[model samples]
Target: MLNSAYLCGMQKYKVHGALTAVGMIYGVNYSIAKEVMPHYIQPFGFTLLRVGAATFLFWCYHFIHGGESIDIKKNLPRLLLCAVLGVSANQLFFLAGLNLTSPINAALIMTVTPVLVLLSSALLLKERVTAKKALGIGLGLSGAVLLVLQQGESTAQGGMLGDILIFLNASSYGLYLVLVRPLMQRYKAATIVKWIFLFGFFMVLPFGWEEFSSTSWQTIPPLIWLAIIYVVVFTTFVAYMLNAWTLRYVNSSVVGIYIYLQPIFASFTAVLLQQDQLTPQKLLFSLLIFSGVYLVSRK
Candidate 1:
């Protein structure tokens, strides 16, 4: 029994690691999008294409895997709310923000999401925000502020529109996570994903037509097409599936903590891809955020 319990614990850790890796891949995909998509597609239009592809792939996966087919009558309200919060609002805010802000600034601003999730969970779910968690939130927020300061003149010159949009993006996603936690618990991940994407597809259809008409399908480079495919497959489908699966075994607050790592991963990827400079201040802030998240999520 002791060894069995130990093995179970190890298995859980492995599963969580896999989920984290999936999240990292999603982050990388977003970084790639930041680099490539803007050259060819408008942000909203790009979102429409990626999400549309993701929706189709997820639907086929559900149908083929013998997963529960979406029952609109039973799940309509939940699906609608998810589509609004998770798909429509979240993506719209993010794409709009990315247009207004530098990718680094956007990434830094988004580190606030875990804190927002904690606060929302505390207010809505009565989840206790212990002293350690509070400290963690403070430390993380401080690190984010430090990062903003470190960016200095460039960030200041970039204006606040992007920053505000990114902030909204973070908040919308946090709320979506909190809102979806229960539904995820009640249904298979694929079922929830299927409905969310289906509703999302419809939500964006009217706005996406111009994009569908204007895009030069034959002229798009193969490498860019490959990036789009990667975003659809690994980032949209697999990443969300892993996130939903992990939520079943963890609390929303705990799962929310993983978001703190996104900026670190994003910065690393930026350095590798863009030859961006890394400074001591950036390293320190990253450490502060990671330490804060550890305190907040520690059992």
Candidate 2:
């Protein structure tokens, strides 16, 4: 009854849909996650929860569906670098920044990555940078500065501090993407993920331990517990696994496009939920940011 071509098309559609869902989850997570932090948990402490639980889950999944072995000596150093850049430092800064800033700022600032990637490609990979892309990169950076300057209505302790840290986090993450690009060709996604999180757990221990140890879990609300669970299970694990799976059916550009959708999803979700309001400034700066990203991301 089913045509083979139709079946193939459906499978590809579903895979792309899965990647879009990953972006949506990431977008919505900004508001959902900020609610629990510095109230039910500190940023570093929550990072511990995210990395530790996800690490456990990765290992469990690996055991169930065993994969090829990695060369520890050859791979460990690079994987360790990924852990530090991708998993440990990136999460710590993002959550810490999100805690201090509004979800809208956090979400909008993240969309600047395409420009980051283009620049990184040019500098590191020695790829050609056209004038259009150079202008795109300039627009993205200008938008980021504009984004960080807008004051949120209800801020945590250090809004400026959060903005700075988020840029640092974005930089580190951009470099991680570049650094790991080669290894991705050499290893399975799961294999790389397992080692990255495994090493990342240790890298975060010192920064996260005291806050995690001091957390008064008993005083937290059931909703806070649910938020934490969602961070680990849905935001980290499900989003990432779906992204990896999508690679089988789609190229990196498709995956990257889905990431651009996160801020839209986040901004709309926050506005609809009354957690954040749109301003003339926000609208203008956001357009600048996404416009830049569109130019850089376009083929």
Candidate 3:
């Protein structure tokens, strides 16, 4: 017999911890992953390693505590679509973009995801929208423009093309967030996790195979090996699992707000390490995006 207050307390802790952990991982991942690409491995190859390893881990988790089977007839098609947008396209564009662009830019661009999801909900789910949410979306998109325009000003060196790809990646993932919601009500996160990675595994293999094959493992340093493991295990595997766990305790709006912290972690860490430089232009645009996300994410 638990009281409502106690349960509420526990949920708040769980929700906050989960969202913070997720933000830190994504924020740090941008830099860590950047270290590995072009130098040790290409973008597609690195993505292959990430999705492949994650897929295997998900299946292993399923084996230990697998739940009832998913409904194949009605859900398989939906799952496939989710795989394409959520896992395959999302991972592909992101890695490709990150390889070409600076990590700070990538992190800042990701802040728009909530705005994208909100708009999609309004259009696709026919959810009612208010003025605040609309302004938030506008501000969020506008901030991205500000950041894009300031590309060369900061120490970040990626080209305009990279930023464009990352924007596309964010768009794909935002759509995934919208589409996966209904399916989430129908299935356990564990069950869906396995399928999403498996489908993504196949989708990425062809594109990644050549680059993955060309890479020579012998040349990679121990530090890079550790980074690879981090991407495979922590960023891809644990992050996703934690996100699913956190969703059980908090609403999606709360989850969206946590995303705002990612750029903070990413930019601070990158600047501290001297891997990236901070500029006034970035700060100005970051303010716009953060304010936008805040407005959009507010109830």
lDDT of each: 0.74, 0.72, 0.76
lDDT by residue (tens digit), candidate 1, 241-294? 887776666666666776766666776786787656688988998888778766
Candidate 1 residues lying further than 4 Å off, grouped into runs, are 1-8, 69-71, 144-153
* Candidate 3 overall lDDT versus native: 0.76
Residue-level lDDT of model 3, residues 1-299, one tens digit each, is 11112335466566567777988898889888998998999999988988999999999998998676888678888889889987888898999999988886787677777777767766886656678767766776676656644544453456678888898998887787667666665677778778888999999999999999999999999999999999999889988777665544433444555566676567667678885678887788778867875674444
- lDDT by residue (42-97, candidate 2, tens digit) is 99999998999999998888899997788989877788887888899889999999
Evaluate model 2: give its lDDT.
0.72
Question: How are the candidates ranked when ordered by TM-score, highest leading?
Answer: 1, 3, 2
Best by lDDT: 3
**Displacement of the residue 153 alpha carbon in candidate 2, Å:** 6.1
TM-score for candidate 1, please give it.
Answer: 0.88
Which residue pairs come into collision in candidate 3? none
Instruction: Please give each candidate's TM-score.
Output: 0.88, 0.78, 0.83
